[model samples]
Target: MNGTDLLALLPEGWRRVPLKATCNFFVSNVDKHSFDDELPVRLCNYTDVYKNDRVSPDMELMAATATPQEIERFHLEVGDVVITKDSESWNDIAVPAYVEGTADDFVCGYHLAFIRPRKEVLDGRFLFRCLQSRPVALQLELEATGVTRYGLPKDSIGLAVLSLPPLPAQVRIANYLDGEIARIDGLIAEKERMLGLLEEKRAALISRVVTRGLDPNAPLKPSDQDWLGEVPAHWEVQPIKYLAVVGNGSTPSVENASYWSDDGYPWLNSSVVNEPLVIKASRFVTETALKECHLPKIQPPAVLVGITGQGRTRALSSLLGIEATINQHLAFIKPHCDALHPGYLCHWLGHAYAFLRSDSDGAGSTKGAITCEQLANMRIPVPPTGEQLEICAHIRKSLDVAEPLQSEIQNSLNLLMERRAALITAAVTGQIPLEELQP
Candidate 1:
């Protein structure tokens, strides 16, 4: 990231200059707090910068209070660039979001840097594109400091170098990029929308098969529970407690070093529920920790459910493919009877995800937790063992057909993102000629 190395990376017409030479930059300390003495302002917070390419007037910003001095010093304006100065990882450091348009009250919030390009030497849009480029971005990443939480020091931000083109050329490149990027973004949005539809289809398929038998003309019977509605006539509708041994586990004390080891008993947390099948442990707990914590070692053919979480995590289910112990936030259901297949049970739980979440919210738990007792009492449709296996096979076959299509769409998305980044880098660095974009 030295001047010579950066200059070498740029084309002949482009010259390298320190970022501070082309822009006025400052790190903001104004936080998301309101005081009676301070004036009210709409704050462009860290997420606003991290999640968007441009911060515009249409986006809803956080409401906070800032002192007159802070308001004067940190007020946002058009053509200004906001970058994340601090993050949990180095890759996220110095992620820039341009201020496309802003209100008078909009001020930069904490953990972000406000950069205004010196218009005589740099076009704001072009500078923003340069920041998105790999050559300049890599410099910021290398300068980031900290072990757990990374940050770009003010000196590093000021010293970072950029490939500068002539003002007219910068404007031309920016304009070309703006149009091209929009098209790519539109394509990406469509691919993402398709992914959403696929997910909905997958969920619907699982829900339908688990609740109803594979036979199209199967007779239906009322299951008493509103959520259960009508199930296959031959299937038994009963509380889970009758078919499985439902229980939970606990975490060992982290303060005791002996509780954790690299080679020890496999231990999992509620996040395991995110995976359709849990085949490996998240971490390891020592033998003494397992005994002292009274953690139950759940065997295979068990269904794991995230019983506690604030977001969509609650009621998410996963099939345990390996012997493991879980934290208290997870409930393990080990089928004790011969009639129920763990796969079928997991699918049923997946189908019941929304209902379980609703139940958790209405149970009057302030934290939105589903207890072991609640899970145990929940009703499920139980088809014959033979039918359950066939249904599981059918679901897997359906997934096999859908999985490739999803992967193909995902690959297309990856390529589009790569192309977008490469195009921005090429244009900003003058590697691609402006004439190429002309009709």
Candidate 2:
């Protein structure tokens, strides 16, 4: 918001403060040696910062290292802000969150920085919202400096400013957002629950129907594979190579930026097709670019994965959106024969995804991988073609019911977020008078 817009809403005596003056900027200086079996330091990284403005709810990971000077310098207090000091993309940068660590005196790493504010100047939550606003995010990007990739520089932070209203108005904005955002969160939480159940039901449908067929009375035999436990007597396990023609894709010339375009053929990345359903309109491709690249023509509705990337998303089982080429980081799969159900295979492959990651990342490699041989050798528990169709039908129907219910929940969550934003807009702009919330 501009100075005039803030003035239109604020009471007399209110002043806009340069962010540096409004908050105490503490530089992060994490040493790479303070890690050990320790009683003291609580490690924090960018991954710990969630969109929810919360620290990582789970404690599975820890910090790299810390120094005594670094530790004390990085101490966090309630109402203080923590944010990613730098990011590859401004959009990827997390919104500021008040200190949310579980530790009594938590320490932040180099990847993040802290902003300790004078309690009288601004409401911590409202300032956090200010940071989350699109205008602010764009500002961060436009002003940020780096060689090739833009990054927020510590020196540039103080120079950035806000159209802050009076302290009382700031509290009102924070209170409004807090009171209303909770309702939105409830909606989001419900949507998440629906999504979880849909996924579970989908998996159960796949595992059950694929292994046992539609007829329960169908005699079953033991599948000796320990991971698979058992399956129907009629069914057999086969390698992926027998079912589909698989290959890797390439980036024609990322070095030649002109090869990439917003308008043209849909160049499919594994990410574009990461849904159960076949997606259309991939990230974008060109005929020239396609001819130049060795990307195989992927048929619609093939299962896919990222052969690389450190995130769980890379390990996900996704269906293709279009007939397009894939990158090296992706491995594609398609089923063969009429009896082999594509949907059934998709559901099954999705089930095996995590197991595959664990298997590779465990002993085979410190880093996760799905080698060409490993992919070919990968086992598929196959039933008769008719039975495979039946399983696919069952899964599609269950997900058909579940997906829309989840969509509605997601829509509700969206509204809640909109409402939260609206509330902030209103209070900060004084569209809703502050007296409404005051005792």
The best candidate by lDDT is 1
Supply the global lDDT for candidate 1. Answer: 0.88
Specify the poorest-scoring 10-residue window by lDDT in model 2: 31-40
Every model: Cα RMSD to truth: 5.3, 4.3
- lDDT per residue (tens digit) for residues 1-439 in model 2: 8869856655565555578888888767763345465335666666665444755324544645565666667867667777776653455553566664445446766667777778888777777777766555456656665422346777666666666777777876777677676667777677677778776876777667766678888777776667776777778888878887666777666566656778866565545435655566535667777777756777766777666544465566776756766666677776555545666677776767777777667553535666656776777788877777767777777778887877787777677677766665555544565667542
Query: Candidate 1: where is the Cα deviation over 4 Å?
Result: 1-6, 13-51, 60-76, 82-96, 104-122, 135-161, 166-168, 216-275, 278-317, 323-340, 353-386, 434-439
Error of 2 at 427 (Å): 3.1
**lDDT tens string, model 1, 1-439?**
7857856867667787899898999999999879999999999989888889999767898899999999999998899999999975588899999999878788999999989998898999998998999988999999998643578998898898887878988999889999999999999999999999999999999888998878979999998988679988899988899999999998787678999999898998777788998998757999898888899988898999988755466899999999989888889999998888999999999889888888788735534899999989987889999999999999999999999999999999999999999999888888887688641
Model 2: residues with Cα > 4 Å off, grouped in runs? 1-18, 24-40, 56-63, 68-75, 84-92, 101-105, 110-113, 118-120, 137-161, 250-255, 285-294, 307-312, 335-341, 360-373
Report the alpha-carbon TM-score of model 2 versus the true structure: 0.79
TM-score of each: 0.70, 0.79
Prediction-by-prediction clash tally: 0, 6
